[model samples]
Target: MFSDRLGAAAQAIQAQFKHTLGQLDDVPVVRAMRHATHGGKRLRGFLVIESARLHGISSAQSIWAATAVEALHAYSLVHDDLPCMDDDDLRRGKPTVHRKWDEATAVLAGDALQTLAFELVTRSEASPEPAVRAELALRLARASGAEGMVLGQALDIAAETAEAPLSLDDITRLQHGKTGALIEWSATAGAVLAQADAAPLLRYARALGLAFQIADDVLDVTGDSATVGKAVGKDASAGKATFVSLLGLEAARRRAADLVSEACDSLEGYGAEAETLKEAARFVVTRAH
Candidate 1:
């Protein structure tokens, strides 16, 4: 059921992106934009639309938020795969944006994508209320900016050079910003749109996001590059600390399962309406790629 919804979300966002990008002039940068945003699980976007549905928000309005999150996520992946960053170049089973094009084009495409995220979210058609649009844009900026995802990336880079490997707590903090922050925002987007209490979804997202990363760490150890759609085993090769490294394989898997349970429990307030989200939590940990 979740897989079907996820696939539908991916298709919806792709159509939204294609239509939005069609307004731009035909050029290499535009091409790069299309390339970078082409494919993904679209989990973040799915969370946005699902959360909105739970809140009785219209899909038409919520889709803009969903697309915005996906765009920002794609931008992050493009920059993260740059020569100066993680370097080795594969994403979503294809060449990383920098490798597919050039580094300069990749950089510009990422920048434009980031800006376009805000443009999509703030459009009057998706969200007519100025305050709601502002809140979404503001929260997105914080989640993706220095204090959130960028901070996590910076810490990750620093860890590579640190004398000692990061502690478990350190990695948790890092992943919270890098991975968890955006998920939290995505999951809470409907609550934000509706001006409703978001505490439950926020709590659910925190657990789900951590479980997702733990699964990533586990996959890094057990997954093949072809199946995972990116270079696998880089963490061990780099000697970076990860949940798998710190807790051992079985323990890491156990921890992810526990987090998934917690994430599902956090949705109790939403009753049967949140069953799909609960399934999503389980899927995050069980997915092979």
Candidate 2:
């Protein structure tokens, strides 16, 4: 079904990035790049591709957009693994950038990658309009900056010291800041690129982001390294706020399903062009990882 196509696209995009990373001369940089790039469903890139398709945009344009998203995603993961962040030793089943290299090197590498992502978008062949490309870059910046990902990470660090139990709303807000904002942009950036105007797309992406976060929480509770490519139950062990922690597993799972249904319904006007996005909604809730 959609899994096969989605998986193929994800795998292909990762491979392309891996090839690019191989050309770098620095060992630590190479290792960090390789570690960050390995193993994942390139969901953000898929969103860009599918969103573009919905507006009759070609795959050629989507490829470059996908590449930029992938680069930005890798940069985020590398930083997330640093001692200042998640402080992890593994990502996608391999040693994290900080583990593979020194912390300073990992940090610099991530910083470089972040800038490179913007560069990618600026020079992307798929970008038919520089202004639009810049706008998309701004979207990514907003999604990944203090207003979005960084703020969420800060809250995550803050929660580590709080004595009180996390409320459901607390969990939701954290995820909305962390995972949901990025995901919402990832889904809608394509629509933005396609020049497709619709209020429902925004609504769909918002719900889709929440659904994606809930599903991640479910997977963290229920998945394993083999399927997830990262440690399972890490959230619980880290005492991080999650839907499953506040809503209960059953409730979180139900919410995820509901969000997916709503997301899919939002694309009713798109017909077959939105099949990838429709299937993506299902994949979000159903994914093992």
Candidate 3:
């Protein structure tokens, strides 16, 4: 059921993307933007939509927020795959933006996508209240900018040339910034939209985000490139410290399961309405990509 819901969400988001991007100019950068966002699990967007659902928000309104998060996520992946960053040639089982297009096109596409995320979140369709839209934009900026994802990326790059591998605590802190920030934003977007308290979703997202990163580390070691849709074992090959490297494979798996439990527990107050989210948490650690 969770898988079905996830698939539906992905389809809806992709449709939104096509409709939105279709209005843009026909250019290489625009094409690259479309390509960069073509496929993925759409987990962050699903979190946005599902969290919004829990708050009784209509899919009509929440789809904008969900699409915004996915656009931003796509932008991040495009940049991450550039030569100066992760330098990968594959994503979502296809050639990455930089590989499919020129580097300049990729850069411009990523920039355009990032800006489009803010535009979508701030659109009148996303929310009737200007304050809510403004709040979403503000939080999105913080999550995707210097204080969040960028900071994490900077730390990751720094770790590459550090005197020694990062300690577990160090890696955790880094991941909290890089991966956890946007996830927290996505998971809490519903409450924000409804002007309700986001504390429970925040707690759930923190655990889920960390677990998501741990799962990614596990996949890097245990998954193949075809299944992962990206380069595998890059961290190990680069001698980069990861959860699997720091805690061994089985230990990392157990830790992910524990975190999934913690995430589900944080949703207890929502009762049966939160089952989909709980299933999503479990799915994170078990997914191949």
Candidate 2's residue-wise lDDT over 1-289, tens digit each? 5777677668767766776676778676666666676777788887776777677777667766776777778888888878777777767777777777788888877887787677767775757787888888888899888998778778877888899867877877777877777777667776778777846677788889889888888888888877787767778997877788878999989999999899989988887767778888888888777
Colliding residue pairs in candidate 2: none
By TM-score, how accurate is candidate 1?
Answer: 0.99
Q: What is the lDDT of residue 29 in candidate 2?
A: 67
Every candidate's lDDT: 0.94, 0.78, 0.95
Compared with the true structure, the alpha-carbon lDDT of candidate 3 equals 0.95
**Ranking of predictions according to lDDT:** 3, 1, 2
lDDT of 3 by residue, 219-267 (tens): 9999999989999989999999999999999999999999999999999
Off by over 4 Å in 2: none
Q: Compose the digit string of candidate 1's lDDT tens values, residues 198-228.
A: 9999999999999999999999999998899
Task: Give every collision pair in model 3.
Answer: none
- The candidate 2 region of ten consecutive residues with least summed lDDT is 26-35
Q: Model 2 — TM-score against the truth?
A: 0.92
Task: Tell me each candidate's TM-score.
Answer: 0.99, 0.92, 0.99
